[model samples]
Structure formats: structure tokens, C-alpha cells
Target: MLTTRVVVRGLAGLLAAMAVLVPSAPPASADQVRGSQSRVLRTLGVDAAWRVTRGAGVVVAVLDSGVDPRHHDLAGSVVTGPDLTRGANPRGVRPGRLHGTYMASLIAGHGHGPGRADGVIGVAPAARILSVRVILEDDEPGFRHFNSEARFENVVARGIRYAVDKGADVINMSISKDRPTRQERAAIRYAISKGVVLVAAAGNDGAGKADGPYSYPASLPGVISVAAADRALHKASFSNRNSLVLVAAPGVDVFGAGPGDQYWVGRGTSQATALVSGVAALIKAKYPRMTPALVAQALTSSARRRTARGYDPGMGFGVVNAARALAEAARLAGYRHTASGAGVQDPDLPIAAGGADGRPQLAPVQVVARDTGLVTMYGAVALGAAGCSAGCLVVLIVLVRRARRRREHVMIENPQADRRRRAPT
Candidate 1:
């Protein structure tokens, strides 16, 4: 479904334009887990519980620079993409080259092979990748730091649309703009309509003035915002907190595949967002029929809720729990099935939490007759169907029994002696 090539222009110069006053972030805390303990891997039971299940048949579109498709860990998982920063050239596309590539590796890179050569393994190692290069061509150094303006909002929107067209089940926007543009919001809405789950960083400016509503996509409605957590599972000093943030993941000291088969570590919401995106991929893979609403609920509900009641502005649902989320998804879906199959119909079937996107058709279940009478009617229909099938089966058994009785009688009457006399005559 991926249709058009997005053209990135002046905006490529924007990513590095941030003011120099932004202080250098402190080194990641020692308690922080290295890249290996990313929330995505922990939540999804990567090595301990989860085994590959067809790799989810889900594609995650990475709206960043071109991915090193040949990376040891990502060789087969990558899909060809456009260079939004500059037009495709013979030399190849390079936006914020290392940044984008590293992000991709965290989500789906195959990683180093035996003996430390494989590099860091990504959270969703089996998921497919779609890279969109949007960094400016003239701002290479700015790409390294916050010295230029990154036209990421527009490019991100367009890239999102392309990702939806390409059948991506999840979209990871690791890049963040100083503010959310109308275009960016609209693009996000469009992607939602297409059934794509979007994840974004809460921002690295948590300790600085970069706090407050200033966080763009992370604070935006419908986005699965993420904050950074250390190895001890505590929030990162630089990671922003608010009710809008959905969860936290291992961000500090997170390592990923870099250019030239190397690995690098960094501290930022970018890593957290990638890890969450990977978790989403795992959920989609486990339950192909699940809707985004159900997936989100499962993720939030399974999380170790923050100390505050309800959804605290700091952590939307809590830290994600891979095993618990999958278990919850299966449990909820099962309950829905039971309600649907009961003698009565469940009127709320149309509005169940798991069927929001409307991609898969819901099987009619028995509607319970309650204050919500409409549900009762559906339940009646379900009972009727079950009853009808049972009645037909009984009728079939009766007919078979009658035929057997008749055959037995004829065999008894025609004894062996009578058969022999008729044959001789």
C-alpha cells in the first residue's frame, strides 16, 4: 500500500537549529540497564518467555533516515524506503544518518552474531522496518546536536501517511519537534484512521524549560507517549513526566547498531519510544485480530501502575508488562467471546474496547438483557443459533438409528440356509 515518495526540503535544516543553551545531559546513571534490558524486551518476554511467532506479520515504519538494511541483525527485516532529506542519489540517502539508523536497529535490527559481533539486539527483532529519511542535507553537524531546525513535523506527517499505505501496523516517530504543528496532528489522525498505532518520545528536555505543554506529539491525543527509565526501573532525570505519557522504557545507556557495524549508547526519549513501539509490535503479533484500543488497554492495564491513583499525569498506565499485557489481551478477548455466545446478546459488542479500528469483523455473541435492552436481542439471536444447530444434530442421530434398525431386521430374516437354497436352485 505504500504509494508516494515524500520530498523533504528546507525542514531538513531544522533539526539542528535548537538554541545552544540546552545543557549537555548527564551521563546515564549506573543503575540504568544497558541497552539489553529495554522495556520492549522485558514486557514481551523476549528471551525468557516469548519465542518467535511468525514475527507478528507486522511492519513498523521508522520515520527517520534510511536504515542499514544490511545490518547483521536487520538484513531481512528491512523494507526499502525513500530518502526524504534529499532525492535518492547514486551515492545513497543520508539524513540524520547515524541517529535514524540507530533508532531502527533498536526496534528491529538483527543484531551482532555470536562472540559480541552481532551488536545490540532490537526490542522487536522480528518486526519489519520502513525507514523515511527527513534530516536536512546541509546540516550534518547540527544533526549531531540541537543546532539546526528539523522540518520533522511535516516530514513526519507525510512519512506517517506513507507508512499507513505500506501496511505498517505500528509507527515509531523517534524524532520530536519543539512544538506540534497542525499538519502533524492531522497526519496523526489520518494514520489512526488507517489503523496504525503511533509512538513518540516524551522528550529529553524533562529537567529543562522544555517541560510543560511544550512537548509536541508525546502530549498529543491518540499518541502512545513514552518516557525514559533506568535499569532500576526508575524514571530518567531528563525524561519528562505527565499524564499524557503512556509508559516508560529503558532509555539511558541503551545501545543499538550504528554505522559500519558498530554499536553506540545514548540517553533520550528516542530510545524509550523505540522500545514501546517494539512492545506494540509484539502485541499485534500475538493477537492479529486485536484493535488499537484493546492493545493500548492491555498495555496500560498490565503495567505496574504508578503510586498515584487512576492515570497519573506522570505515567499514563505505568511501566509496560509484556507477559501481563499479552495475558490480559487473551483474557479480555475470551470474556468477550463468552458474553457473545451466551443465550442472550451483548448490545455493547459494537462498542467493545478491542474493536475500535473496525478492521476485523466481530462474531455475533449473545446479548444480555439488561437496562441496555438492545444487547439482549443479539444475545437471543446467538441462543437461537446454538439451539437450532443442536436440534438438527439430534434429528440426524434419530434418522441414522432408524436406518440401522431396518437393516438389522432384514439380515436376521434372511438366514444363511435360505441364501444357500436360493443359490442352488
Candidate 2:
């Protein structure tokens, strides 16, 4: 159970300040080529990554305000999963409720103009989005009618579980709370166990308080915590600086799709988190069997180290390098073979070798071939599942079976039900 007083006291001041600081949504526009203005894409080498993979056959779950699935830039990418907020209509677009839509576009938006270069082309343009509504608009009328912190907590927890159960490859949580609860921790652990990659924002309270409490989910174990970087690859002043921050991305003046077929600019760790999530989707598309821990390793290991030393409080490892990370993932996927002995050739193999003396000598050589069979198998499976969209059905069946077993266990533990019924007559 949650008390309204605690939530009001904890978030009222912060939410009020954000309403004034964060830019308001702009009017709908016809110009769709504005995505080139996004500095993050150019700085992070997204174009090079796209040459290798476009995040096809991957699903990223966005947990935030409801996304506008019908947005021009996000058409056919957004999949409405669930609306956990109380009294809020599912998938309904309301004014001041476009945060999730913006985040979704940043992760997987496919531009709608004359060509692919137009509009907001997300870092992972071919990825699909699983929109899970977990936030409610504070400006809505009768906002106090909803339940207290418990409601918010339950919604977030449920959203995480739902995303994992629905076969989300990467889970992007752009929203943040000051602290983590038991339910939230359990939900995150559950997702990690299912091989889901979790990414979250490091909070935006960095003006005078660089030492604020670590943000929830982002600071949680097994979650990739992201900080905000500006166009120059420097940490944003408003991005909270904590040791929990794992990496940084371009979050300043980040452009994305908004509600009512409009586009807007946002600045915060939320945008940075979304960018990282998109990159994670790309990695998953290339290597579907990658574990959550290895995914984090791929991002951090290949990051462009900006600081002189090991780590920085503001920048974490450094700005994410998408091309470098993808290259690393590719290397990780190759097969490793060891030679039996140094400078030894196969006895039965015919080899033409020339030394200083005009005599046949063993030529020093080695050959390594990729396991194309395994690669083809995984590729075929990915293509088949994407063609039919049967990924969710498999997960749904597993979840249903688990639920049934749990209910059966409860009935077995409670024999009092039969005793009560027999005596009730």
C-alpha cells in the first residue's frame, strides 16, 4: 500500500520544476527531414551500424507515458502492450502525455517523408516497439483521484513483467523514481533471468546536486544506467552524476516524434537511455543469444573513453560508439580454434613452400572459418519468427502455464476451502 502524502512530498517539487524546464510539444509539421538535425546519430556512428544491421527481428519495450502508435514516424513500429495507470484510457493520446511517444520514436521511428533520410529516423529504424504505459500525466484534471505511490509502483512493476512475458528483447525505461522498491527489484530480476536487456535513465537533477540519490531501475543491478551527453560529447549539466551511471549518450536537444503527428526536442537522461536501448536492440538483432551481462559488456568495452583515467562520475565509461560495439559483438560471435603446435602443417595436406634454399618448406599459415551453419540456423529462425510475429505467442503460452501451476500450488496448500464448504450447510 502507498500513501498519497509520501508521493506528493517526494515528487511534487521535482515534477513542478520539470514542467517548466522541459520543452513543451510543438505543433504538427509537414517537414519530415528534420532527423538530420539529431547530433547524437552522427556522433554515435549510427549510419555505419545501419550498414551492418537495422535492428530487424528485435522488440524493444518502452515503459513510460502512452505512445502515439499512429504517429507518422512511428507507424507499424509501435505495438500497444498494456495501460497500467488507473482511470487512463489504453493507448489514448492526451496533451502533455507525449513523453513515451518521443522515447519510442527515438528508439525505432521510421521516417515518413520522401526518403529514408526524412523525419526522425531512429537509431534502430527496423526495430519494433512494445509500448507499456506506466506513467500518468500530472497535469490532467482530477489527478488526485488516482491512488497513491502504490498505484505508481504497481504499474511500473507490472509493466516490467508484462514486457518480459511478451518477449521483449530490450526493455527501455525512460522514467525514473528516486528509490527502488521490493516489487520493482523483483520485477527487474525476473526480466534479467529471461535474458532481457534493461536500460534506464540516470535522472535529471544535476544542476547543484550532483550527489543526489541514485535513480531506481537505472541504479539496479543488471540494468544499464545511462547519463546525458551534449553535442560536444560532454556531460550535460542537468544530468545527475553518480557512480551508478554506466555510460553516456547524446541527450541534449534530442529530436523525436511527439503526439498529434508532431515533432519536438527533449533534453534529459531519458533521451540518453532511449539511445542506448536502441543500440541494444541492434546488438540483439545481430546476436540474439547474447546474455544481458554480455550486452552491457559490449557497450562499455567498446565505448569511446573520454576521461583520462578509468571512469568519470558524469560520463561513466564514455560516449557510446555504436559501430565499435557492433564490431566487438561480431568478433565475440566468431568461433575460436587453437592450433595443435607452432609452425606445424598437416602431414596429409599438400603445401607448396619456398625458403632461402630452393626446397619445399612448411609455410607458416592459419585459417579460421566461421560456423556458417549455426549462423544460418539462427538467421532462419529470426526470419521465420519476424515474418509470422509468433515470438509473443511462445512467451504467452509459457506465462500461462506458469500461472496455472502457481494457482494449483495455492489450492494444494489451502485445504481449508473444502472444510469451510462442508460445514457451511
Candidate 3:
């Protein structure tokens, strides 16, 4: 879901009491995490974001194939959830749970070692993950059957409800499909209505196509659709380009924890979406009562490399900045969460007030283009000046004709005088 929102209930007691804000660790610990962190996490400044909060008290639901809870990097972080496949694996194809494990590691990997440093350190390292199996790998046994037939098409919808009921603060669906079913839409609507922040992959269909097909769940009204950005910060060739893209993340040559306690390198919007879901968990952990709309506003309003229009189909607002988004959440927290979910989500409109938590603004919306009014006003004035000038020219031409006629009449009456006047002068 993309645009749907609801009035968040119960702003009670969950501020400082809910999240045990982990103070900034000593330099040695921070340095160890930084030194061991991969280029991808470092690129997003996930280390800097840890200074504020490590996503202490939030639960992110990973709706994917299935996660390997025994992985070294994700030992205590995973809560194994239901197997929603409804059917067994195909004859020869086995379920590796490779894709799901990789995505989970990105969202909540707790690196293994003395300083928790020898492996991948996820964006929200302290966030817990609920592994809800909804989709299978492309090479898995029942992959084609599950995707092509209607027998188990509603698994995702059921997964959403299951995650919500399991007390998931954020739901991360790194899968995409071509069509939308009524049950899926209703499930998403139900999740959003319950203040669950939804995120999904925009799809991997970019290469030859300008704008790819609308990926379902990503294109839905309330889901935050993630695109894949290359190293140079451009949309990846395989990443889908569409209006549904909310923000992009480093999705090229991404390495993460895989099943069997191994590390794997993968690329796709699935990784990008997982990274963004981790950031959402970070925000949720800090501001326990922040509404879903505010969570999205924090991400989009503070996105990096944004265009002048604030949005583009290639990357939507821009790439996700973990530290910047958390700072934005601090600003949006003070806004009175209204029933209609008004005013605050708009980046263009000035917020009546901001949070007093004293976080610095990384990027602010500087330019305001009143294009419609200015164009109409200037266009009307130019048209009026042109009309007035044309009328004056016409009047002058008529006067010259009248003067020429008078001269001709005088010349006819006195041909000799006219010829003398026209001779040499």
C-alpha cells in the first residue's frame, strides 16, 4: 500500500519507557563495528545511525520464503514463523530458504564475534525479525506452480494478517507480483489501518524497458516501494523504473548472510527493500508511537540525491539515508497526528511546529515553485501587451493612409507644384 493512512491510536506511555535507548557505545566498540561493516552498510552510514538508536524495541516482519535462524549473524534475532506454502516442495526442487535468509540478515543481522564484528551488521542491528514464509525461490520446487496458479495465490494476504496478529510493527515484503487480488488489497488495508508500516520491492525489470510493469503490493496505496540504486547512485539497469518507487538503496553486488550459516552475494530490489525496512524499525524503536504516515514522511522528506521536483520515477524521492531519516522522524514527532492524516506528510507545506528533540536537519526543502499561478499571471500580462501594441500599430497605419490620400488630392489639384516638390528634395 502506498498512500493510505489512518489515525494512530494510544500515544500513551511508550516513549522513553518503551525503548531502552542504548547510549552511544565506547569508541572501541563503534570502531570495531565500523571496521567490520561491509561497503554496503557503510555507504548508507548505518554506523552513524547507531549513535541514536540500534532499533532496540521494534519487530520487523520479513514476509519472504523463510529465514535460517541458526545463521551466525542472525542467531537470537530471528523468530521462526509459519510455513504458509500450504503445499509441499516439488519433487526434485528443495527449499534452500536462501533468498529469505539473505533479506533477513540485511534487516536484523547481529554480527558474530567479540564486538559482534566479524560479519554483516544490519541497518537496525538490534531489531528483532519475524520470519513469515510467503514466497519461494525461483528455483524452488513449487515456485512456478505457487506463482502461476490460484491454489496458493492468497498466501501473501494470509501472511500479512499473520504478521499483524503476531505484533509486528513493520511488515517487509521483498517479493513482487504482476497482479493484485482482492484479499491482498484487503490485507494491506487492514495492516495500514492497524499502524503497520509496509514496505515491498518495486521489482527487477529495468534493462530494456523505460518503465516496467507496475509491481503489485509495491504499487499498492500504502506500501513503501523500494528501487535498487547502483554504486553511482543511478537506478540499476535491472531495477524497475516506475512512479511507485518511494526510495532506492544499494542493491548491486550486495553480500549478506545466507542459509547454512554462510554468506552470499546477491542483487535486486529485495535487498533494497529489506534495508529500508530495517531503517523503518530504527524509527519505530525510537519513536514508539510515530504513525505509519510519519514514518514514510521521515524517509521521503529526508531522502538523499533528490531531484528539484522532490520525486522521480527512476528513484522516487531519492536514496535512503538512515541517519537523515531518523533526524526527520524527530522533527515530525511533534506534529499532532490528526484523524485524517493531514498536513505533516506533505514536504512542501510548512509544519506548524517541529519536535524539540534537537536533531539537526540534514536536508531541507529549499525551493518553492508557484508555477501554476505565476505562469497564468505572466501569460495574461504578455497577451494583453501584445494586443495593445497591435491596436496602436493598426491605428497608426490608418492615419498614415489618410495623410497619403490628402497629399495625393493636393498633388492632383496642383500637378506643377507636386512635380516641383518631388524633383530634387
Measured by lDDT, the strongest candidate is 3
The local distance difference test score of each candidate is 0.63, 0.76, 0.77
Summing lDDT over every window of 10 consecutive residues in candidate 3, give the lowest-scoring window: 8-17
Write model 2 residue lDDT over 63-89, tens digit each, in one string.
877789888789888899777765543
Residue-by-residue lDDT tens digits, candidate 1, 216-278: 666677788887776666777767766678887777666665555555566677777887787
RMSD of candidates 1 onward, in order: 16.1, 30.8, 15.2
Candidate 3 residue lDDT tens string, 176-212: 7777776688788778767899998888767689887
Model 3 global lDDT (CA atoms, 0 to 1): 0.77
Sort every candidate by lDDT, greatest first.
Answer: 3, 2, 1
Q: Once superposed on the true structure, which residue ranges of model 1 sit more than 4 Å away at CA?
A: 1-44, 52-54, 87-93, 112-117, 136-153, 208-211, 308-310, 334-425
Provide the TM-score for each candidate, comma-separated: 0.64, 0.71, 0.71
- Worst window of 10 by summed lDDT in candidate 1: 13-22
Winner of 2 and 3 under lDDT: 3
Off by over 4 Å in 2: 1-38, 88-96, 145-149, 334-425
